[model samples]
Target: MTIEIGWKLDNSYVNNLPELFFTKVNPTPVSSPKMVILNYPLIRYLGLNVQTLQSNEGVAIFAGNKIPEGAMPLAQAYAGHQFGHFTMLGDGRAVLIGEQITPLGERYDIQLKGSGRTPYSRGGDGRAALGPMLREYIISEAMHNFGIPTTRSLAVVTTGESIARETRLPGAILARVASSHLRVGTFQYAAKWGTVEDIRILSDYTIKRHFSYIEDDENPYLSLLKEVIKRQAALIAKWQLIGFIHGVMNTDNMTISGETIDYGPCAFMDTYDPATVFSSIDIHGRYAYGNQPNIAAWNLARFAETLLPLLDENQERGVKLAQDAISDFGKLYHRNWLTGMRAKLGIFNEESEDGSLVEDLLNIMQKYRADYTNTFVALTFEKLEDSSLFSTDEFLKWHRRWKDRLSRQQESNNSSQQLMKNSNPSIIPRNHRVEEALEAAVKQGDYSVLERLLDALSNPYDYSIKQADYSTPPEPSDRPYRTFCGT
Candidate 1:
């Protein structure tokens, strides 16, 4: 089938680029290729000819069996501090095909995840299980609906092969899209292995691609560091406000594009506990819900270290500049978190005691172990006396204070209800529900549950009677929910 290939692309990483930035890799052809899903919206966004991908031959290209003419597939190299330990790591199972310039002039990386081994695969298979591949597809889309910046999935193609993990599972490839896959690890890798010139080249490339406004600044690299810090601060604050735990905050998982990357072992906290952790390997709770902001700052510090030479010629001046930028993360995250909290409380204006009022609600929530998502959802309504949510003396006391605080605002009740409804979603991808959906698809050959879940998740704020079950928290039977990296 000669599908008319309409690939408007370029390979900047391979053109006039040092070999150290990446390793040339060709994808291993699968035995049998099958189409699982295609993102029609993204297809139009990338300005691709839809006719080319609807046929069986398109599965071959998506499953990494066929490469487009202008595609230069390669595995990027990077190093990271994984759980406070420095290790050289790279794209072990992912391969970037090319940079697709959209019809609107925005550039994005099109990569195939779980497309077999590369030079970076250190004593591990590069195959991905269908469950985790689907897990990522579901979670990333949910995150997008939440208005968070994140990498998007374009397609998931089945390879008609079995992969051996904890159990033998069907293999699949995820075609992922992102502004860029460059991470803080990339800079670390360049600084550690490449010369100062290499680091400068990377800094320049990052500025040009993502932070173009600062390219002509007197200290463009320093400004770049500041901007990245601000982005990360705001991002982590948003995650905290929404009860999302990244599970793993390793430098390699932190993208310089300011988008959330790597969906492994991530979960939303059902109960409003700051120490909530779902990742099986995070025994110490280093990346817990409460510790995310600190971990993000620590990761940014490592990023700053890689920009020392580019920050300034004088070593002392550069260190001071980096420290000043890193110090702003706390103020930035606090302001961002407070702003989000104020909105969740339906307050249109800020007061000096607003922070304390927000803390009091969360304090009571944690004390009573209330459902995190439902508590805010219930606030948007007129009365809660008849519900199980406000049948406590402690909650009653706080509810009165909250109403008193709201009365001082300059907003109408209808507008405040709408704001609260928008700020607090009625539905989140609960860990137990996600597990159920994955179990049905991975073992039962049924994908209807997942499709339905995605449909319900698309409008999380809307209170639909049919989707009521998705809003409930997991019962005691689902206690101590555990997740793994699926490596």
Candidate 2:
């Protein structure tokens, strides 16, 4: 019997782009695949039939054991500056099945991560472990709930096979949906290796897909660069306002669509330390919480480099154009960050002293080693009496100043509080809680913990008694939280 569910797959990527962009490939089959979880909400969003996708055939498709009709699997090619060193990289353990056209007419790339080895698999097993796949699923969904731009997980299925990492771990495949997988590194690869015509074709295709509004500009490529810069600036500001450390902001991981991709070694900060880094590989803290804006600007500069030829016929003029556009990044980022900080602090109107007021609060938080999320939550709900740090003279003085600043706002006190409530999340995917849930699911085969954690994280801004259960920070005796790439 053939399984069919009216899959609306329109493979624009493979059809519209040149052969140099990707290589045709099929997912390597897995044995005895079992569905671990399914995102019913996402299923409906994509206009997929939920009942059909809940069947065994759907599990097989998600596990890379069966291919769906109209799916054209391929491994994309790209290059990246990993830790500031240029290297060619690509989809080693992932295969883009096809672009699914939703009923609303939006197209999304459906990818199977940990599907198997590809031409880009240099010298190792191109497989993903169960824990890491689940981690991405949890974190990505949490990020989405927080109103952040990110790739989303549609499903996760275990391979029923063990792969050796530091130890034998259960294998799994993640069904990831994204606006597109185009990255800054994709342009780098074309610029460094392919013909000039390849870049032009790619630029045109990208503009058509993501930035079509800019296609009519006199210099569409330059416009594309500026638009990317704007999106990335605002995106990084959002991350900073939430204490998110991407941990690994490699050129390959930075998406052209400005959506957060590749959830490797990413974590939200607990303590209010700007220098916090959770990736075990980030020994120098290059992608620290405070450094994300700078790194984003740096990556955009590299992206600008790829468009140098397209910017102008004269190399000097093109460089200048790219430089001028890149220079706006800091101001753009600062404006976004300041506006967000104002909202978080319950300031309803802009004031000259608002930046210093926000900085003073941060300085107190850092000096007292306060929990980042909780401190904001306290201010949002006026629960500062709960924390002893609020009793300190430095904090008390700062609090008085904050109150004075709030009085100058045009909005009412109630409206200002409502703004803060919306800005400050009551719950984040706490590092310790995430680890606990993963341990139970992976080691004990108990998903109840993971399910419950997901439920608590589903509505981050809603402050409820249930959310408080997962809001507690790690115990003092616990080891420092570290994350892996899970590659």
Candidate 3:
């Protein structure tokens, strides 16, 4: 049967860019594709026909067994610094079907992850394991619910074939939707390899697509750099405010749209530890929770390097301009992070002491090893049940100071609490719970656990009895959790 849901797909990226930016490709056909899960809410949001998309033919399209009309599958080319080591990389196993135009007239890139190998596949089979694909589906949706800018997962479909990883694993594909797949690395690729004019073309296209308002600026490329820096600073602040660790802060993973992408080894911090590292491959702890801000500044510096030619006519003047802009990253990130911290602490007005106040709370959390999410929740809801940590003299002193600070605000306690409620999520995708769900679905082929977990995570800010079940931290006796890149 032909799958026809009237997709409004267009190859805008390929149509606008030269062949150097991307290469045309198709997804490798899978054997016996089956739909594991479909994001009906997201489908409806995109104004797609949900009923038609639930059919078997739709599963084939998702699994790379069939290509739909108006879909021009291709693989994007880019380069990145992985763990500070420069390398030429691109869409090894992913295939961009086309940009989907929603009923509301918004454009989003609809890509197939783990679809197949392309020119960028570095001597490895371009197949994805079912567990990791579903993991991305679960965590990405959870991030979206938490009000973070993130790529949305449309569906996950299983391939009736095994792939060789640590052992034989079930194969799957993830249909990912994003504002655009352009990354900092894309600029890096154009800068290091292509001519100066190439960077100009890519920058102009990016500005028109994302930073359209800046097109009228005298130096639009410089404004583009500043805007990207601002967005990234704000985006990283949101991640840190919610205790999210991106695990791998590679240049390739940082989106030009400032949306969180590449959920390979990303995990939420359970305990308030600055030195948290979950990615097994991150042996040096470079992308730890505390190092995220600094790493973001570093990545932005790399991005700034790619735009030096367009920043100014004189090379020397361009370098100075880039340096000055990069220098502001610290101030930008601190302001954004401090603002978020103020909201989390229920502080309506900012003061000089606010930064130290937030720092003191974090120090107490670190000193007592308090749960990151729950500690904020306790303060937000006045749930002082955790006497083991909250009853200490140090914490009590901090709590009294916090209360005094709140009293000074003109807003009523009710208003402050509401702000805190909006800023701090009561629930995060906890590591142990995520692992349990993946274990059940991957090992036992039971998806009820995953579905229930998703339901609990659907409303992270609103506290409920069902959500409370998954809010508990892992037992102390449990082994330390580690995550893989799933390559």
Query: For residues 1-487, could you state the per-residue lDDT of candidate 1 as single tens digits?
Result: 4336467777876774588989999888899978877777788889887778877767888899999778999999999999999999999999999998888999999999999999999977888888888889888888888888899988898889998887888999999999999999999999899999999888888898899999889999999999999889888988998899989999999999899999999999998999999899999999999999999999999999999998889999999999999999999999999999988889899899989888988888898888888888878775465346578887789888888988998889888888988898888899888999999988997889988898899888788875688987777764599988888
Residue 10, model 3, lDDT: 83
lDDT of 2 by residue, 186-293 (tens): 999999989889999999999999999998999999999999999999899999998888889999999999999999899999989998989999999999898899
Error of 1 at 438 (Å): 0.8
Q: Model 3: how far is 463 from its true place, Å?
A: 0.3
- Quote each prediction's TM-score: 0.97, 0.99, 0.98
Of 1 and 2, the candidate ranking higher by lDDT: 2
Lowest lDDT sum, 10 consecutive residues, model 3, at 1-10
Query: What C-alpha lDDT, on a 0 to 100 scale, does residue 399 get in candidate 1?
Result: 80
Q: Note each model's CA RMSD in angstroms.
A: 1.5, 1.1, 1.1
* Per-candidate local distance difference test: 0.88, 0.92, 0.92
453 Cα displacement, candidate 2 (Å):
0.7
lDDT of 3: 0.92
